[model samples]
Target: MTLEVHGMTEIQQLAGKDLGRSAWRTVSQELIDGFADVSGDHQWIHVDAQRAAAGPYSKTIAHGYMILSWGVPMFAELLTVSGVGRSLNYGVNTVRFPAPVPVGSRVRLHASVIDVQPVKNGGVQMVRGFTFEIEDCTKPACVAESITHFYP
Candidate 1:
């Protein structure tokens, strides 16, 4: 279940809190292909399954950005702040890929609120730490500090 907060006051209290994880989602070749089409990144390791089979990971892998892109939907399973007029993606503060997410792998996000600060125009800026783990793997597919703005 997602954690809901009343307003800015409640959001402020969320800092330093680990919000838990999302459901395990599979990274299929179709998903990777779609991301490749949109991103124009048709690298063999990501799109050419046949070629990728003999490459680095021994199979196709999802693009790093595609794995990182999982943050929003995964975060949706974590927190929701009500009483806000609008919310905006303020981009990422930092991102790293410790391990690759091979196609057909199941992954999930474990997220937490790292920091919260007030921005102009009655909005609150927050830094959320997201760790996307490839199920059954020792390393994480991605670790990112994403920034967002919530307007009241």
Candidate 2:
């Protein structure tokens, strides 16, 4: 799903609604490598497939931040508002990595609108509560609640 906002006024109306789930995506080695390169975090567990095969997880896994990156896209699939000129990422209230997302695993996200409040300059601030689950896994890979500021 794609989120399109024409202005801030419309965004204010979606402050506290369920924004659906996103499509499942596979966690690939190439994605891990790219994230490692960009973040300078080439941890063996995330980049060394061979070595990681003998480690506790038994396979290279995605970085926690990489999984967290799906928050916006996943939430976008669930909810969209018209009339928003622009939006800004304000901050995150909480973030937790509950499980490792091994390479080749599929994952998806679930999101809900937690709060929406008016901000200065005719803007609105919205918060989303998110839970990310790995395909076929009982435990969620990540749980995060983030805030976004939308300007009219």
Candidate 3:
């Protein structure tokens, strides 16, 4: 379920709040190969299953950036803001890939609001923390801090 907020003030109140986790999404080989094709990063560890079987992790793994890019969609599932004329993804502040997401692994995001501050033009800037976790695994696949701007 999404954490609904009506305005900037309500959004600010979510600071330090854990919005909650998203539904599990499986990482398929097709998805990885598609990312490799579009990104021009056909790394063996990510796309070559046969070769990666002998490599570390014993299987082809997903690209770190591929997992990192899921923050926007995943975060949308965690929260929604109303009464905004527009919203922009300001940028990413910090990112880490702590574990390999092997092909066929299920993953989900756990999100929290780190901070919120008013900006120019009656907008609010927010820093959100996202932990991309693998099912049944203790270590996360990726961790990222994303900044966003919402204008009323």
Candidate 4:
């Protein structure tokens, strides 16, 4: 389910809230290849399926940044900020890929509003924690603390 909030006041009240999980999304080889093409990171483990078949994960794996880049879209499934002038991705404080996301795997996001602080100009700085959980995997594919500034 999506949590809807309007304006800075509503956003400020979200401190320490567990926003919930997003729906599963498949990690396809084509998608991985596309990302590699755009990012110029055609690592053998990421794009060479034939060579990757004999590699560590036994298949092509998605780049950590590819998974990180999904933070916005996947997080949109859990929360929506409306009635604001704009929302800006401030940055990520930390990010780690604890496990590889193999092609043909499914991943979902588990998000929490770790903190919300009032910033200058009637804006709110929100620290959102994200865990990209890979289906059937013991460790998460990615974990991060993404910060955003919402202005009214």
- C-alpha lDDT of all candidate models, in order: 0.93, 0.87, 0.93, 0.95
Per-residue lDDT of model 2, residues 36-72, tens digit only: 9999999999999999999999999999999999888
Highest lDDT model number:
4
lDDT of 1 by residue, 2-102 (tens): 99997888888898999999999999999999999999999999999899999989999999999999899999888988988888999998999999999
Worst 10-residue lDDT window, candidate 1: 6-15
Q: Model 2 TM-score?
A: 0.91
| Residue ranges of candidate 1 with Cα displaced over 4 Å | none
Q: Which residue pairs collide, candidate 3?
A: none
Please provide, for model 4 over 1-152, each residue's C-alpha lDDT reduced to its tens digit, 9 standing for 90 to 100: 89998878889999999988999999999999999999999999999999999999999999999999999999999999899998999999999999999999999999999999989998889999999999999999999999999988
| RMSD versus native structure for model 4 | 0.6
Q: Each candidate's root-mean-square deviation in Å?
A: 0.8, 1.8, 0.9, 0.6
TM-score for each candidate, following the candidate numbering: 0.97, 0.91, 0.96, 0.98
lDDT of 3 by residue, 53-119 (tens): 9998899999999998888898889899998898999999999999999999999999999999999
Off by over 4 Å in 3: none
